[model samples]
Target: MTVSVLLFIILAIGAAGYALGVRRARAAAGGDTRKLHSLTGYHGQSVLLFSAVPALVLLGLWLVLQPLYLDHRAGAMIAVADIPEGGSLDLVLADVRRVAEGLDLLVASGGMTEDDLAAMGAADSDLKARLGGVGVALAGEVGEGVFEAARDYRHATHGLSLAMAAATIAAALAGLVFALRRIGTDYRARNVSEGFVLLLFIASSLVAVLTTVGIVASLLIESIHFFRLYPARDFLFSLTWNPQFRGGSDLGIWPLLWGTLYVSFVALLFAVPVGLLSAIYLSEYASRRLRALAKPAIEVLAGIPTIVYGLFALVTVGPFLRDWFAQPLGLGSGSSSVMTAGLVMGIMLIPFVSSLSDDIINAVPQSLRDGSYGLGATQSETVRQVILPAALPGIVGAVLLAASRAIGETMIVVMGAGAAAKLDLNPFEAMTTITVKIVSQLTGDTEFASPETLVAFALGMALFVFTLGLNIVALYVVRKYREQYE
Candidate 1:
């Protein structure tokens, strides 16, 4: 049966069971109203929650794995001979891919004519269509082998969906049966039901734990490979960074780290002041109309794709800085120096800072603003003395978030920042970043088992650790500030 139909059956039973529980609880409590641990409503809530949570978790996990499983199984179904040769292999494969895409869209879009969907989903009603009506056409043209493979793929998809749907419905039904069996004189239905409500509370904690664990695991595995190629001391503290596999040489991380840090720092220098000022203007100074119009306009900066930013750096900003500030007063560095990337990165981070800081500024209590006004404080003094302090912790958190974003950002730095490995402070000279190196190492015709390719994972590990530390610190600071307010 389809998942929706099965779930509806389970839900029907659970609702009936919950109603029985509430009735039983009310009867037990009577008019004295002290017999049960909680009210009748709690009994109903518990039954509903107990019936749903486990089933929903199962459903969600299944959905996440479904695409991967389907793709792997489908691809494997096309053997070397069954797919034909040369150009025909390409054509048949393309046809199969199109059919798969159509099936996915059919499932997603949720409407179909019988003619479009007929043979494939006669395999199962769950599959609404196959692309180009090709599934049926394949039976003759490609012979028995290709036809058999197509049939197998269709069967596997149906089985997976059915299995997932069946499992979810079974859980929900089991919960309902348990609730019904317990519907007796003096059963603790209310307490049992409220325990189900606790599932939502548990979900938030699980998400945080899972995210931390997953990031740590990825970094740990990669770092292990990286340490294998380069010695611990040199990798961590060497003053030069050069990576090579073809000519044989030394690879030190210091130069890359230096470049990465310098560019990020420069980006932060520009982003913070502009972002903070923009937030203040929007939150305190602008009229509602002005805020409404301008907020989206500025946020448009963030929505502009990162590749577009990269192209803009390459075509415009990199050369502009080279000509304008870098070469002008002699304090200027080279055109594609630290200054170019830092400036562009700062522009990229402005939306992040402004949106976050604006929210923080708005969060300052109205009572504080009123108190300052009552004391006849001027607009500037009220905002300066009363408002900004209250919002300082959050604003600082926002800046750190922007900083972390700058560190992890790839395209602008890759395009604007030059690939030099110098440890100097001159903004005119070009510099490289950790991410750029990660990309370079991972790309080209390298074997997956080689040290050169494996080093990418190590660099990835370092990046993860760096960003994770910043995020944790920011989260802690923001939480402390919130608790004080509460």
Candidate 2:
């Protein structure tokens, strides 16, 4: 029984249990719903929750742990001599998994039978040819040790899967029986159902919190390893950003940080004014029909992928700026420049700002505007004094969100802004960001043990810290403004 099949069986059992619970509860109450301690739906939901949750939890744990157990068992069979020169345990284990999967596919697809697989050995059978018949390609010929390990892996996997299916089904059935037995006229099904719902909400929140903790812990560990190999002072303070995989590299944060801030500043400068003005007009002056039609059309820009914007910057905006503005103004004439990426990124962020700001502006009470007008104030004066101040906190939040979006963008910087990391005041000069450098450092054939590869995690940690500070500042500004209004 596969995981999917097992899940389906559990679901079918849960559904049947729900129906039975509802019917049994009504029967116990002599078909009088009001005589029951809880609603029919609550009884049904309680049974469903009891039947599904424990079984699903068991299934999830088994699936997660089964792979680790199998890998450990298989890895034990491979001696140091089994690994080829210039190869590590990870590489051998990868091949072991691949071969194991291929053999499973071969057996399932009827390309090989039980008797044939049992009799098969590296000396007796063409393992690669058999796998290929089932569309599983190996990089090289299967060695004797790897072939034996894969067979063990397949056997362990099959046994564990069968055991998992049986255990999960039994758990679900047991839960179903227990819940049905408790479905009496006096049972507190409503309270039980609400408790289950509360547990679900708590589980969802824990998943998000745990995910953040995992990211921070991973980054911190890898960054510590990175700092051990490379001096933290050079990485943090040095002005240069040269990462040589061959050693003696100056892996500094300044150039990348400078470029990130400069590009984001330019983008915010372009987006905030235009987006806020557009929001003001839409909220304060536009007709309902026009606002409805125009808002979605403007928000359509948000749906246009960042990659598409990158291409737009690369082909159209980059050249246009270089030919007209940069060259004519005696600035740098590179087609790929910070200005190219910044302008395209600003266009991409317009919808985020406009939509959020428009909603915030509209949320300002109509009574405030009316009072401002009654005080002999002009429409513009009313907007400036009453509506703008009221919407200031939300507007700040929107701008900060857009700024975060700009700072984290990679594709536009890659395509429009060139990959040269430098600190320059000239917008026409090509530069790169931390995200782009993070990507560059991690890619290619760079060894993970090297400081060059580890620097990616350090860069990531810095980016995380910067974004956290930015959010803190945004919250402070918003709170200050909100207090004044209150």
Candidate 3:
């Protein structure tokens, strides 16, 4: 069976088990809410874990090992003499699997035949007919080399699939029996099931933590590779930041750092005033009807995908600025520049800053405001002197989040910020960020062993560290402020 089919079947089994367990547990408890050992929902959840955990663990193991085993088998079968230039064994294997996946779909659809190669395109029919028509009319079942690899891979995969299925079935039976056996007089099924529920919660939380660790691990490994080629001094100082993949070139820190700071400063210029003032107005000034209508409308900016913002920066803002500001005033470049990305990114971050600050502002205790009012302070004075002071740390925390958001933004920089890695004060001049270049280095055709490819990793590590530090500081500040207010 295909992976999708197997996953669907597993999910269905888990859902059914959960539903049945809830029904049985509820019935067994004589419909007396107080007499039950656990809630019906907890019983359902317990059954889900029983049906899913083992199967998923097996599936994860299979996915990890399958590629290594396939590489081994493929290497053994295809001689070194048969491999082509500019082609890797992995690429060849990927091609083989794609064809195998196509064949599997054909088999599942019961559509296979040999047909004419030249005339097959003339047919108009359903997918099944088209597939069979192409098979019969265009070519043989598959090329000999591809066919060999596909058959071997399929045989091995099918064996594993059968074993996984058998294990899952046996485990499901055992788990059901075990759970029902424990359903007895004075049994604390609630405690037992809640333990499992908590395990599930930890499992979900671990996914986030593990993903972060994986990214950092990737960055660490990549940075090591990069540092091997470029010396620590060159990476840290020496002024210039032009990077090329060919020979040993001077790779310095100054230019990129300058460009990053310049862009960020411009973004902060736009975001801080607009976001903070909007937050103040929303929290302190807006009527209920105005708040209800305006808040979501303003937040609609956040719902727009980043790619769409990139497009707007490139097509609309870039041209307008080039024509109006650069050409007429002779300020900077005639194309994409740092200001374009900064301005667009700031627009994207406005809702982030405003929404968060609004919450923090609202959370400042009413007693503080009442005290200020009792002291004969005006609304503006109370907000500026008393409420804002109380919430300052949290607001700083919100601003820190916005700053990180600006730094990590990619599509806007790639599309609208100039790719030039030069040190310049002119916002109109095109500039590049570490993220924009990281995307460029990683995408398209790449040589994984080269420093050019590896530089992405080093840059990624730098980005991760910078963002992580920002987050930690923000969290700490927000927590400290909350404690003070409480």
Candidate 4:
């Protein structure tokens, strides 16, 4: 049976068990609620939890591990000679899975039978054409070993699926029987049910921690693979960024790193003062009506998609800057330049800084402003001295958060700044960032084992580390200054 059908059956059984447990508890208590250790509802909940939770856990484990076991067995069946040149075992395994699925579809459609599939030979039959008729396309002709492996894979999968369903249902029934027998007047059903709930809450909290660990682990492993193929010093300190798929390549990171920091610095240089001043005006000086109208208007910039921002950078901002500033100053001739991307990215970052700063400024205690006013300080003086210092930590955090956002931006950099990686001092010269290079390196037909493809992971790891450093600095600044204010 299918997993969904089995889940439905298990839930139905749990429902029946709940009703039976409640009835049994009332009978044991002589239909007197005062005699029971816990409420009748707790007894029912206990029965439901026992009947469903174990079975669901088992089903989840089976679903996760079954495919891994099947894949290993199928991979073992394919000989090394069967894997084509310029291909790995993973590619062959993909073909085996596709062919196996196609065979199942053919059998279901009455185009083939189990006996026919068993008797089929790759030497005599056009396997690709037969599978294609059933809507499964292969990259190349299937070998005899792959065909046999696929057949065995399908059979093993079918057998395991049946076994999983039976075992899950049996577990549900066992739990139901055990809980029903334990449903007495003296049973501590409430404690047991609440324990399960506590465990569930703990598991939910660990999910975020586990997810972060998984991301770091994956990036670290792939980066290690990349570093083994290429020198770490060259990847880190070399002055150029170029990748050759054939043999020799110059995969330096400095040009990309310089472009990323230069763009982000330009963006922050524009965004911080404007956004912070806007926040100050809205929070401390503007009337309530103006605050309501202006805050949402500013925040609307954040809602527009990044791709839309990229297009705006491409069509409007890039050309306007080229014609008005870059050409007039003779800094550069190109429409796509670092200044173009930085200005457009600064526009995009305005909402992030303004909204966050406004909220943080407003969060400051009113008493500080009142005291400053009582000391005969003007509103502007009070803001500059007392309010600004108090909100400095949060403002720093907001700026760094915006910086992280700017560093990770790809579409704007690609559209506004051209994808030329170089270490130049001119903001008007087109350059690329680490994110752009990561995408370029991974695009098109490339081998995962090659340095070009693997470098994407290394770049990603570097970005992650840089962003993590920003967050750590933000945290330290907040913690160190926040105590004095509090």
Cα RMSD for predicted model 3: 6.0
Regions of candidate 3 where Cα sits further than 4 Å from its true position: 3-52, 76-78, 85-87, 95-150, 178-183, 241-253, 472-483
Of candidate 3, the 10-residue stretch with the lowest lDDT total is: 114-123
State each model's CA lDDT, in order.
0.74, 0.91, 0.74, 0.92
lDDT of 2 by residue, 62-131 (tens): 9899989988998899988778886777778888888889888888888888898888986656677777
How are the candidates ranked when ordered by lDDT, highest leading? 4, 2, 3, 1
Q: Compared with the true structure, what per-residue lDDT tens digits does model 1 show for residues 1-486? A: 666776676677567767876776677667444666666777666666667766777777888998677656656666676655423454554445445445545545664543554454334433323443433223113433344444555557678888987788888878766765555446666666556557657977799999988987876877787677667777677787656666454566778778889999999999999999999999999999999999999899999888888788778988887787777867655557788888888999999999999999999889889989999999899999888889988897889889888888788888888788779888867888888888888888665556667767777777777787887888887777653553
What local lDDT does model 3 show for residue 322?
A: 93
Candidate 4: regions farther than 4 A off: 484-486
Q: Estimate the TM-score for candidate 2.
A: 0.93
Candidate whose TM-score is highest: 4
Candidate 3 local Cα displacement, residue 265, angstroms: 1.3
- TM-score-wise, the better of 1 and 2 is 2
How big is the positional error of residue 117 in model 2, measured in Å on the Cα after superposition? Answer: 2.6
Q: How close is every model to the real structure, measured as TM-score?
A: 0.63, 0.93, 0.80, 0.96
Stretches of candidate 1 exceeding 4 Å from the true structure:
1-179, 184-190, 246-249, 327-335, 365-378, 443-445, 464-486
Instruction: For candidate 3, list the clashing residue pairs, or say none.
Output: 114-136, 115-136, 115-137, 116-137, 117-137, 117-138
Question: Which scores higher on TM-score, 1 or 3?
Answer: 3
- Residue-wise C-alpha lDDT for candidate 3, range 1-486, written one tens digit per residue: 567777777777788878877776767777765567667777776677767666767777877886788767755765444355656666666645654555556655666432322122222234324545444232222334544665566566668677766665566556655665555334565676778768879999999999988988878987998899778677777777666666666666567667777787788889988999999999899999999988898799989999999999999999999998987888875678988989998999999889999998999889889988999999999998888878788788778878888888888887889788888788899988877777888886667777777777877787777678878877887677654655
